[model samples]
Target: MSHWKHVYEKWRSFEQLDPALKQELDKMADNEKELEDAFYTDLSFGTGGMRGELGPGTNRMNIYTVRKAVNGLADYLVAHVGDARDRGVAVAYDSRFKSQEFAIETAKVLGAYGIKAYVFDTLHPTPLLSFAVRYLKTAAGIMITASHNPPEYNGFKVYNDDGGQIVPDEAHQIIGCIQEVEDELTIPHLQKDELEAQDILNWIGKEIDRAYLDKLAEISKLATGEQQQDKDLQIVFTPLHGTAHDLVLRGLSQLNFHHVDVVEEQAAADPEFSTVKSPNPEEHQAFTMAIELGSQTNADVLIGTDPDADRLGVAAKDSSGHYTVLTGNQLGALMLDYILTHSVSNLPTKARMIKTIVTSELGRKIAADYGVETIDTLTGFKYIGEKIREFESTGETFMFGYEESYGYLIGDFTRDKDAVQAAVLACEMAYYWKRQGKTLFDALHSLYETYGYYLEDMSSLTLKGKEGAEKIAAIMETIRKEPLTEVGGLDVEYVEDYLAGERTVIGTKLKESIELPKENVVKYILGNDSWICLRPSGTEPKIKYYFGVCGSSAQEGQQRLADLKRDMEDVISRVHNV
Candidate 1:
């Protein structure tokens, strides 16, 4: 029998399940299509951890699944240390359906395992939870957030003692424990009130928030009373109906940024994120309302954040006075440039910058211009976080880290991409530029002129269900067997096979070892500073292709990107046998 058949049979015989869950499972009986979609594969646990729709099926995310994961994590932690429970676990949730319930379930599972749980009293951003884990010296941390996914989607993100997501080796162990739990329903959990009574579960309140915000203030660039000349610069921002409503405005006010306009429609924390089709700031439609508000306020800059506020989107007034939504790469490069330029006094010569391998190479040039070194990690924020921990341990300075996905981090207080800190820095940079009688758009164009126009784009081809999984595997196999020697009429200069842990230069016999852990990813570097990478999403059922192009002019860069995208799509289609 297929995976779904087995899962359905097991679920049908399950006793003492919640009525809603039971009903959900019963509805799936004999519904091969839905059942297969839900149970064809296990929820993936990789570098970024797991994210999925919440339901009753084995593959779906639910209370029982949360408990299983937590129990597994508990086992892993206990094995790693004798007093694992004593170090405790910090838990937080964003404003989403069942987010609070899921967080509580995680805490209860830990509590049942005799582990202490420090649960946040209310919704908070993911970065704060990361910071809290390290600040409170917790053994681990958990954040219940779908992070810009639709309202129906939910997820569980696991963090290590260093406040970063569990790396591959640790993730493998956690996955093993999860698989060993033969009976999910039999997992132990403690009642909320009972857990508290035992003094092993503590409810954390505003004090933690205050402390986290205080640290944010330390890195803030607010000018002194008289030096706050840019206080009058008009700025508009929208949280897009997520958890950032109050925290962002509060941070801005604390930094003494006056004339800031918050979009009241998007201010309320709505789990559904009803105002926008998707919470992702990368989509131009996501910024429609914000753009309208920006025009009305004549704002110098506009900013938006995803549901958990871990990534930020930026829109700036261009020379034509029209607001343009900047791509993630553009925003990251602009932020990097601004930080390097303004923080020169505070920056040490040992400062280093980090970007994902797929991120624009313009950032590398900017770092070099500032006499700094730039390192490129894989295509995830966790890799960037790992680099941070590595550098900090070796006594190297971490100036900034960013990905092409609107995630950026400055200070090491948080080990993940921090929209909260990015927002603060964006506003401060806006102020600095405003004082110079220019907008961020002007600065971006200037950089582009000096460093050559760089363009990057991402596309994902999703395949769902059992057949979808098979198709994805076949695609990868075809790529391995018949690698493209050229794309868009450009010769492939280098190929990086992360799975093989080797980067090979074509024709010549040059090969270099990749220090990072191996993953199933393939990247091809073409001539003229153009490249493409293919990798399946660890948490979702999709294969994503990233394209990057650099040229002397914007039009040339765009044309090169378009051609590369077309060629890559052709390769994808052939792999899918479509």
Candidate 2:
């Protein structure tokens, strides 16, 4: 009779459903709250594809939902491509629960449609999946991972032939195709053996790995002699029990980085991520193991990668002899300076850098000093990939791309953020500074001195479930309807409403259209060279606030950021009450 009840009834009527799934459904039969939460709506496939907790329901990540998503992709490839079977699709997974199973199931679904599926034989990082798409010349790609999410979560990320996540238009078409599939339970999948026998299924391994590693090696800016000399720099790395263990170690080894040590406890492929509360490298707690190892080895730098190994985090010893974690903005700025300064001779005539709008402006300033152009995209790395595609057409070379969330790309070989590449470059940067008797912290200080003190902070308020969804919508609507003219005693000189696709100058009341795609985000520019932006995270049930400020000194910058954060929270509290 109701939405949940209808879904429950439909799933109950499926005769061939897996017994485990049926058991899960039975457990929810009497729990109305849980049932509604699990079936009230389909798990959305956004621009990055569907991600949710693993369970049995339309609103969860399960075999049925995976089949449905893959079926939709299969149909789209068949309809849109000239030779879908020949182009095929590349599939990879990480070390999460059932990730390998999900990858196999996806291959099976595509195989049933007479579409070839190139799947990795073992758990691989997300960037390799992106590289596989281009190396194999696949029509599309799928990565079964949730990036840095907890062990309870898993997801499917779909990429186009260009190796970037599907943009809005293609995502819409795929969603349309998914909706057309009336019964997810009945989606056809061929047997793995049969698919292999018919040449519709293939397992990719060493060859792809070798090619990817070769391309990654090219990302190193240090000369062979320089890398050999820098090999004395002590380094510690941890994969956070995810997928980067092998490739990162091997990449560093290939570059002659001999004094590297891995946090042995966190080096294994652990689905539960037993070593940390969360697998996200962006969080300080995730670096606990690596930091300890760094101290023992007297390492110059420490690095950690999340579960899917697409994002990287770094910790370096300050002048006080204590390790301090660098925020994503800080790390991005350091990496940009390192790359541009070391590779000036090898850079193209028109080199460019790309960053998400939420990223700090300090990177732009550094790029300007190097005479390289900087471009801003929306929040997702997919948009950055799109810009790379545009650069290819215009004969502009992409030097680097990164997001505030710790994702980064150094070279064009991979269409996703690559911690492996970042780790290598980060090690080199640390070594370069260490050789000069300066720490990475010193490099950051020098940047501050040259570019003025820039401080940035981010906070997310997560609201879950149906009621929470409504509250999030209301918060965004209220902010859009009544914009803030001032925050923390700073005058708002301009307001950029991304949803409305316009930027308005408060003083002159002049408005200009924003050139980027429309998204539900609002940014306010302060007269003091500070800014604030509010946007709902596309992949999560949370509203994120980003604050940035520039001051005369580090202390001034930190204080201003604190004031802005407090004032912003007060503003949000009032808006929520309304």
Candidate 3:
């Protein structure tokens, strides 16, 4: 018998299995392929915590699998964190299927281990969960969300004491702890009644919400009285049926932005994301309804947040009288400029903004213009959050942190990418320029005119199941063994192998250790801020090819991007064919 079949049989035979899950198991009893896919491996943590399609299998996300992960977390905290039981953990969830149930299970699992849990009573955004870990001073936090993944998926994100996603080092330790839980069926968890009786499963809200809102207020700059009178500059907002449905609007309202209109079709907490194919804010299709609303209202700007509200996307009226979506890098650069301009008095000497390595250089250049240094982490926002904790002790103030995936963090109140806080700041920034008789599009164009027109694009290839994983690994190995020396008639200046933590200068054997943590990433640098980076998606089953270039004008930038993309696609075909 196959190992996966054995695991499936064992789960099926368990008497205490969830009835719904048992039904699913029974339905797949004769479907060997489905059973194997479902049970081939246990759900594991990626850059985010355990995330997978919801199903009744060891590899899928279900009650048993979720319980196993939470049990491991509880055990890890107990053994490594002093007084962890008393400090406890905070739990929050999004509007995904089974998110609330998973949150409850997380609390019960902690309760079984005598660890207190402060579980939110209603669905909330991911950043709020990060903030709860700090505001509550919990040992750690658990957020039940798959972020911007499709409706069929769900995830478990764990945050350390600093309210940041656990870094690679911490994730490694937690993985080991999870491995120690040999049998998912044997994991123990307290019932809700039992948990309540022991005072281990406390419900929390209201106060944390108030505190987070208050913190947002401190960071949100009020529009000048003249800016306030620019009431004709309408704004369209949409949460895309996610957790920020009310708070983001309330946030804008608190700042006295009363002319805001909402995309009513997507204002509710909908798990299916019925209106959009995917709930991701980064994609243009996600803004279809918002764009319609914006056009109808003649709104000056449009904003959208991902399902968990950790990422925010923006679109504004361009000089062409059409709504153009701003890429994550463009928005980050604009916001950085606004923040610096407004914060000249309060700017620290060593203030800095952080971005992922794959993010465009425009923000870095903008930061430099303001005498602010920009630091690059690997791909994950966890690294940004980790740096925030480090900077706290180093006396370097963290001005902002953003990635090219539309995730932005302005205030340090939340360790993760915070769309709500970003929404507040972005609205203020848009309004500030509105008072100057300009739109965000105009402000963006001014930046490009000052700085060279920088452009970035990425392509992702989806691979599924165990075989797909093998191919992804092979693609990385092939690329690493034979690094590119030139791309699109441009010479590769350096090849940085992040997995080896080494950067090798082209034509020279000279090597320098990379200052960041080692990860399986390969990047090729070209002259003039043109480069290529290939990395596996941390949350999804995909490999990504990122290309960026800059030119004196938009047409030049567009041509360069097309040429680079064409070259990279050829490289991908060669690697995949092998």
Candidate 4:
């Protein structure tokens, strides 16, 4: 039998299921393609957690999968900790498809295991879940969200007691427990009201929100009277129909900014995200409404958060007075310079900035000028969160951290990337720049001057279906077997094979050791200050190639990047035959 057939039969054998889930699965049975896509493989519970389409299949995200993941977590908790039932877990969900239902399912699974569970009463952002984990002092946390993925997708992210995602060692333990649960149908759960009667389930709301906001308020430092006097700078914000609408606005309003406007049409909690093709704010098209409103109101800046409020995107009026969207790298560099210049003067000399290896290096230059250190982690923001935990354990201050995918975190209040905090900081920086009779564009130009111009771009090649997955694997295997010595008219100066934990320089006999966790990623550094990185998507059938180039001027940077991109594309196409 085919894999889909086996998976479908397993689910069909369940003696009882909620009527709604039964109906949904029955509806999918009529479409062979949909059934196959839904059941081709079980939704993976990997290093981060489980993510998949929300529907009725072994592979889809539903109550059953949620229960499975949570049950595994409960088992892990029982084995690793003493008095696990008293320690409890924190649960929060965003405004995505069936997010609330999944969160409830997770709670019931925990409750059935005689474990305590504290869940948010309503939809909350991902960062808040991270905050609640540390604030409530829970043993673990679960966030039911897909972050910035499309409306058709949903997910669950697991965090440890430190409010960061599970690292490789912990993830392996959880996966082992998940594998031990052979019968999903036999998994236990509790009724919502019954769990409430037991007093093991608690619903948390406003108090936590207030605490989170108060911490966000202290992210930027101002003089005694700055908040009251700097109130006229205009800005527009949109949540992209996610969970951060009110929270972000409240945070900004608390800063005493009077000229802020919310994109009312995009403020509603719509799981379908009808206002945009994709809720991801990283793309300029996601800000169409915000830009229109900004142009009309002459708003100094525009900000947006994706569905889960973990990622942020910004648009600023450039030298031409036209709205230009800032890439995640650009925003991180700007925010780093702004926060360090404003906040670090009062702090100790050992302050540090954290960024992913894939992030642009401009922030590093700025931090160096300020006499601060920058640390590079792997691709995921979870590693940055882990670093924050390390800092807390060792009494080192974590000033700021960001990734190149529109994710930023400040003040360590949240273990994940926080669009809510970034929105506040963006507005504050815009106000400061406005007071200087300059725009963020001007600020960026000054940054380019202080640090040389840096240009970076990434391209994703998405493959779907089982065949596509096989092809992607083949490509990676080929790259590992016959490494390229050159790309885009430049000699490969160094090749970093993360899979092997080795960095080798061409024509050199020495190989340096890397301390980071092993991942299947490869980086090729070229001689012209240009580099290309290749990695397979952890959750999807796709491979992403990132290219970076730096030059003496912005025009020179653009030209070099264009030429490099064209050459790389040619090389990749000829090699892959796609």
Per-candidate TM-scores read: 0.97, 0.98, 0.98, 0.97
Whichever of 3 and 4 has more TM-score, that candidate is 3
Give the runs in model 3 whose Cα sits over 4 Å from its true position: 223-232
After TM-score superposition, the amount by which residue 445's alpha carbon in candidate 2 deviates from its true location, in angstroms, is 0.7
Candidate 2: which stretches are off by over 4 Å? 228-230
Q: Which residue pairs in model 3 clash with each other?
A: none
Q: Rank by lDDT, highest first.
A: 2, 3, 4, 1
lDDT of 4 by residue, 1-578 (tens): 99778878777767687678788888877898988877887688989998887788777888888898898999999999777789799999998989998888998999998899999999998989999989998999999998777888899999998888999899999999998888776799999998999998999979999999889888866675886564888889899999998898888888888788889999998988998988989888899999999989999999999988999999999988999999999999999999888876586567889998888889889989888889989899889999988986677778889988899998787888899999888888888888899888889889998888998998877877767777777787778787888776778898888989999988888899878999989888888678888888876667888888878899988987887788777766765784
Over 233-338, each residue of candidate 3 has an lDDT whose tens digit, in order, gives: 5889999999997789777776777889888899999999999988988889999999998888898889999989999999988988999999998999899989
lDDT of 2 by residue, 155-193 (tens): 999999999999888999999999899988889999899
**At residue 311, what lDDT does model 4 achieve?**
93
Q: Write the per-residue lDDT of candidate 1 for residues 280-379, one digit (tens) a residue.
A: 9988899898889898988888989988999999999887899998888998898888878877777786889999888989999999999999988888
lDDT of predicted model 1 = 0.86
How far residue 400's Cα lies from its native spot in candidate 4, in Å, is 1.1
2 or 3: which has the higher lDDT? 2
